[model samples]
Target: MNLAMRRSPWATLTVLALAQFIVVLDVTIVNVALPHIQSGLGFTTDGLQWVISAYILLFGGFLLLGGRVADLLGSRRVFITGLALFGVSSLAGGLATSPVQLIAARAVQGFGGALLSPAALGILTITFEHGRRRNIAMGVWGGLAGLGGTAGVVLGGVLVDSLSWRWVFIVNVPIVIALVIATPVFVRPIAPHQGNRSFDLLGAVLGTGGLLAVVYGVVRAEPVGWSSAEVIGFLATGVVMLAAFLAVEARTTAPLVPLRLLRARALSTAGGALALNGAAFLSMFFLTAIFLQQVRGDSALRTGVEFLPMGGAAILGAVMATPLVTRLGTRPVMMVGAVLNVAGLLLLARVDAHGSYPTGLMPGLIIFGAGLSAIAVPAQIAAVVDVSHQEAGAASGVVQAFQQVGGALGLAIVSTLSTSRTTSAIASGASQSDGLTDGFHRGLLVAAVYAVVTIAVTFLSPRLAPSPEQIAEAAAVAA
Candidate 1:
């Protein structure tokens, strides 16, 4: 670590958090620019979904491997390599003139993100003491996760409207460059595990293949019905691959994911809640974005601006979570978040063709955003709370992978249901606006159901506090 980082760990954290912000920001920034990209590249509606799906596929699929690699190698090394690759991929994506080229670049970008995200989180875990300081850092990290998506929508809109859609991708180049230069100076290096240096090649292959197949199957289910042969084939293949992976992990001397980790109540329960949270919250963004632009006839810029309140609410909630968790504990805070999310989604379900923003959307967005911060912050903290330093990356990866898979699966289910509703309404002679509104409302109701389930699950989770070893280690490092 450089003098600056040694002097103030917060500076190091800022660099790491900014790196995370860029990766998370990329996830949604492309949403607002999809229309421009579709027109420019002459993409069909079916093909357009690939733009997002491609990134999600690689990111989710390779996350475990990336995290494992970080633990086996060094967090600093993986982080720098990932940052450079992401920057180059972003530049390539920005300059692409064909859908194929853009999609390929996006896949590469996802791989880079898979590498960067876990390593960054691991660094944060090892850097801060597992107490108030770490809690505050986690809150900031979680807030940025919420902030990134909200900011992405707004930034994508501004860039698309004021300049070109390409600017959305291009914007990453400078940020990546700055991060690359600063990372080595600010971040301390983590040593690899001495016990097992062997790579889990088969596990990596099976896990990645399985996740990719599953996400692909989910995305495909929308265009082709769930019962379609193509969807069935992909889902089957994914299941087999994943089953094989589990078998491999159970036998391997140096497994990519230690089976023992999943046995922990706090980690397991946090994973479940994170998955449900991702399903409801991520899909809400997608559904709401479409409703704002397609159904309500709002411009991209206006849609982006309107989401600012949600962003602010999310940040506020995340900031508040640290103190609340300190006072109340993780499970209670998570339950409260789930209840708030359900209320928000229920309110949003009342939206109609003629509904105004204040009554129909604003209240729900604000409440849901706050709930999002509440759940996400604590869940993430719980995932790595008592984990050994060597396993930090892997634990973080598990939580994130569940989140990605859940988001993909939830979006598919919701999209299929909503589209079916819209198609049925249109067939019955309802106007386009009314049909769309009806479909969106139904989707929101399903999301509310997801929130309800999350609340129920919170009761089963064990209440976990920072372990003594964790606090001692953190204190030693600080001293």
Candidate 2:
């Protein structure tokens, strides 16, 4: 490739970052708009969860498959297609007048997201050279991840309050259209590698169906009764299908997720931790947002502002953890993160109705942010450590797949548990809505317990760090 023929690095970053930012930003944006969406669309409690779940389900389900498509079909083509689909879907969602339409559009957006996100990462790693520049780029990438979650809440709150929630989806149309125009000119294309890599259709069906079943079962555990036949049947079906997927992957020549990747102790363990940690982490954002809005009756912007301190603390913690990860090794750093996360979750149980924002929420938010900062960097590092530079996109895609799936699962489960307990408490003849607060507290406590379990699992992980040789090799390959 001629140097002059290539696009500016800044242009590349702009498109890639915008792609990631939009994908991540929507997660929080929806959180902010949930009440509005529910009211506007006549959504039931179950439908509200679908608002988030629909996107994640497709995003996670199609992610590995999407990565494969980029590899086989060419990243730029796939990316442009993704961009077009996403823009159209957003328009559909923005214009949606009924619950079914909005849910369907969100699902389409997830499919587009699955295509765009991995291709964006592939473009970034390939476009930029390696070494310190790569680290800085990855930092930017990670920072955006950090900011996306935090920014979403803050910005989403402001957007929804000042503008209609429809503006949320409508806003993306212009940005994506602009980015799409720039992509072909600026975004580098992969030379088409000739091969007949088959799509694992059976694997996809089994894997996706299994995951959906497990998610449904977990979500319905509290609401439908843990012992109910429906929950058990779904859980069993999900497990069986997933197991079948694993078996098929091992036997197939081309697999969506190569079982070989799971051989690396650090990468596998880190991926699992990332997923579990996401489950715990998303719970806080969802629960706290509802608390501020529904229980405390705070305005959206106020809710956003109240959380500013947590974002800063989270940044501080993440920066602090990066250096510590170098010195202490990835597994140990993660163990510490898991511990902090549990501590935060435990403390969050103390929040009450009409509670002080700083006094009630700050402690948990700060600690949680610190925990994310510590673990997320190391986990990301571990995931890509052995990935061939050319395959960085695939690695990034897998990590994201785990995250979206974790978010969907966590949101479903936590919502179910809290809502079930709250509804039961209310129906059991509680004097007031204040009685529902108990369910939120209990949910937090359970989440804390889950955090502790994650920490304990961290002990089983390898206490390995990147050797100097591996670092040098990685740098050379990335270059």
Candidate 3:
């Protein structure tokens, strides 16, 4: 069979985009169905957090290994395996009979996704020949990442509101099926990269373990209090394990992160900005939902609808920024985005406890969406800048893993910040609503900080990026 050397035609883009959508949509979809999921599964109070966290911790932690696997194995084969696992895991989660069953299934789902995301990106790299078609495919791919945020809100609400919470997982069934049927025909199988290189087993273990420990510590601190021995011990353990992973990487022959790849100013700045961007994106959606429903008395459906502005704006902003990146380069477009995000988040913080949705919430979401779109796309381009085809999967995987891990950290940190402020506000004898809004405001402040740091990082990004000539040359090197 001939390799799929050209970009995916319309039919291919549609299938691949849908595939990307299914994978990412899973990440945010469950959040909206938390209440329904809890009631259905008879979960313990803390079980809901686990439902989300288990998947995130596993998915984020394994992405680097997963990415490299796509490179070493054929991208097409890995993609198929990942998709099959995802479909099966979702089926299991949907049919879950007990709390343990659900939690375990969720972990399985996370593992499947860990494999799926990187493989999907790698497939795009292979299928989409460099140029306008590649840009559009990536835009669609990037847009779907934004779409996941949108689908999470609308689909979760509709699923829970209309049918059962299980449908959230079940909906993916058809989508996955479509992709499986489509990929073999549309995506030609590439040769397996049987380089002399060996797998980094130590790096995998250390990296995965270190991230899990950090996430565990962050989550534990919320319920156990900051001073609790469990929280402190977990936190300490995370730091030590992460440090050990770094040491191992430095000494290893074929390390997970080749030191040379870090030399590009574009990659470093984009990576740093990505961490902060993750903090801002994850924290805002969740924290705002809490403020809307808990403090301001909005229905679940209403709250979901309210976030449409952010989702829509993000898509629009991303579309608008693409042309600019082609003309102006990556750093400028992303820097502009970082500026908008910082301003918008700060504006969100100023929204009063008694503020109405149309006046306060709508504007905030719009600004944020615009800001998010601008930063996200160019940042993605920067992360994979000038990477050899052999390293395409690894490079993309690193960015994806950082994004997931950073998001996990943000949820924890924001939860803590909100709790502390809410406690202080309550102690000061403020009204219940006021105290709750105060907590949200404090969380937004932290989000604002994330945006600000991202801006500074964007400025640190090199103005120049690899030209179209250079990117096309990359594939030639691998050949």
Q: Each candidate's lDDT (Cα)? A: 0.80, 0.76, 0.75
Compare the candidates by lDDT and give the number of the best one. Answer: 1
| lDDT measured at residue 7 in model 1 versus the true structure, 0 to 100 | 33
Weakest lDDT window of 10 consecutive positions for candidate 2: 470-479
**TM-scores for every predicted model:** 0.86, 0.91, 0.85
Residue-level lDDT of model 3, residues 43-136, one tens digit each, is 7433345676667767877777777777788777888888888898898989998888877887777777777677777677667687767766
The stretch of ten residues in a row with the least summed lDDT in candidate 1 is 470-479
TM-score, candidate 3, is 0.85
Count of residue pairs whose backbone atoms collide, per candidate: 0, 0, 0
Point out where model 3 deviates above 4 Å. Answer: 1-14, 38-51, 95-103, 128-136, 181-189, 326-329, 386-393, 423-435, 465-479
Give candidate 1 misplaced runs (Cα > 4 Å). Answer: 1-14, 42-50, 122-146, 181-194, 386-393, 463-479
lDDT for each residue of candidate 1 in 1-479, tens digit (9 for 90 to 100): 54864637697789888998999999889877776787889975446656776777678767877877888898889989899989999999999999999999999998999899878877887888777788678667755765787789899999988999899999999999999988867777788757677778798789878877876787677667889999999999999999999999999987877778889887888888988998897668767877787778887788888888888898789778756776677788899999999999998888765689987789999999999989977777777777787676567667778777677667666766776787778889999888888888888888888899899878888775544444333222221
Q: Which candidate is the best by TM-score?
A: 2
lDDT of 2 by residue, 24-59 (tens): 787777776777787788986654777888888888
Judging by TM-score, tell me the better candidate of 2 and 3: 2
